[model samples]
Target: MSNNAIIFISVALILSALSFAMDRQKTIAGFKRGWQMFSRMLLPFLNILIIVSVVLYLISPDDIQHYLGAGSGLLGFAIAAVVGSITLIPAFISYPIAAGLLQQGASYAVVGTFMTTLMMVGVVTLPLEIKYLGRQAAVIRNVLNFFAAIAIGLLIGVIL
Candidate 1:
């Protein structure tokens, strides 16, 4: 695990122990409730992680090169956007993947869109987010994020 992860875990454990010491019954109940909520949130992302792993395994240099190549025009950009939406991997995983793609000759613009929309926009999590936050909120947030992702990609393409 990372140093940050270690520190967070240590701090959380210390705080929980202090709380329990102060009020054992209340602290135990609160901890259990927190754990239940955490598990509920984690369950949904389990499928996304599995599928994204499969995608990473299946994809290769030539495959990324041919369709999402420098010469593929808007079609390539569009494809990258779609792939970014589906493969909802975390940023730590994403950075290395982007680095590998760069080493293997993927365009900077495509990678930029992939990285940005991968974090900012989420088609995979749309149903869950909508269920929790309502349709209007989800639509407005995602629409704005989607447009921003595309603009960022295009701007990078034009500038660099």
Candidate 2:
């Protein structure tokens, strides 16, 4: 595991212990609530993991390089951005995957676009965002984010 992961785990354990010591009942209740929410998300998380695994397994590094490498240019960036916006993989998983792609010859521009869109433009969560934030605001936010991701990717390409 990474040093950051270890640090986070340690912090979480310490905080949990402190909370339990401060109020056992409330701590128990909090744990129960958290577990319930986690359980609710477990299926969707598993589905994303499975899909990522399948994609990685089926698409060879050579193919990824061919399509998303430095030579692929704007087309690769656009494809990565769209894929990232639609997919729901968690950041922890996505970063390592992005790093692997980079190592396998994918361009920094494409990876930057993918990572930016993955975090900023949540196409999968559009329905929920629209429900909570209103349709107009949600659409506007996503549209802006898409363009921003492209710009950021291009900048990274130029700088790096």
Candidate 3:
């Protein structure tokens, strides 16, 4: 593992130990709650994983390259942005998928835009966001994020 990952794990372990020492019962309760949440999410997580794996397997690298590579340009960016906004995969899985796409010859801009929109836009959760934050605020946030994701993708392409 990378040094940063090791450090993060170490810090998390230390914090967990400290929390346990400070309040054993509370810590146990927290663990139970966390486990329950994880259990609830497990099926959805696995389903997404399976779907992504199947899609990637079915679509050849050459096809991915043809559609999302450097040559695809603005059209590819738009398609990736829309796809990212609709998809709801967790970041832990999304990153690996993005990396895989990059390795398969997808453009940096396409992958970057996909990652940005996937995290920022959240079309799938718009209703929940609107309910909590109001329609105007949620719509504004998503609109701005979509533009920002495109800008970020372009910048990444320029830089890298």
TM-score of each: 0.61, 0.78, 0.84
* lDDT-sorted candidate list, best first: 3, 2, 1
Candidate 1 structure quality by residue, lDDT tens digits, 12-112: 99998999899999998998999998788676566555665566568886877776667667876888777787767877657766776666667788888
Kindly give the number of clashing pairs for every candidate: 0, 0, 0
lDDT of 2 by residue, 64-116 (tens): 89899988977898899999999888786687678777877889999999999
Candidate 3: residue 71 lDDT (0-100)? 92
Candidate 1 lands at a TM-score of 0.61
Count clashing pairs, candidate 1: 0
Two-way TM-score contest, 1 vs 3, winner: 3
TM-score: which candidate is best?
3
- Local error of candidate 1 at 51, Å? 9.7
Q: What's the C-alpha lDDT at position 2 in model 3?
A: 100
**Cα RMSD for candidate 2?**
2.8
Candidate 3: lDDT over CA atoms? Answer: 0.93
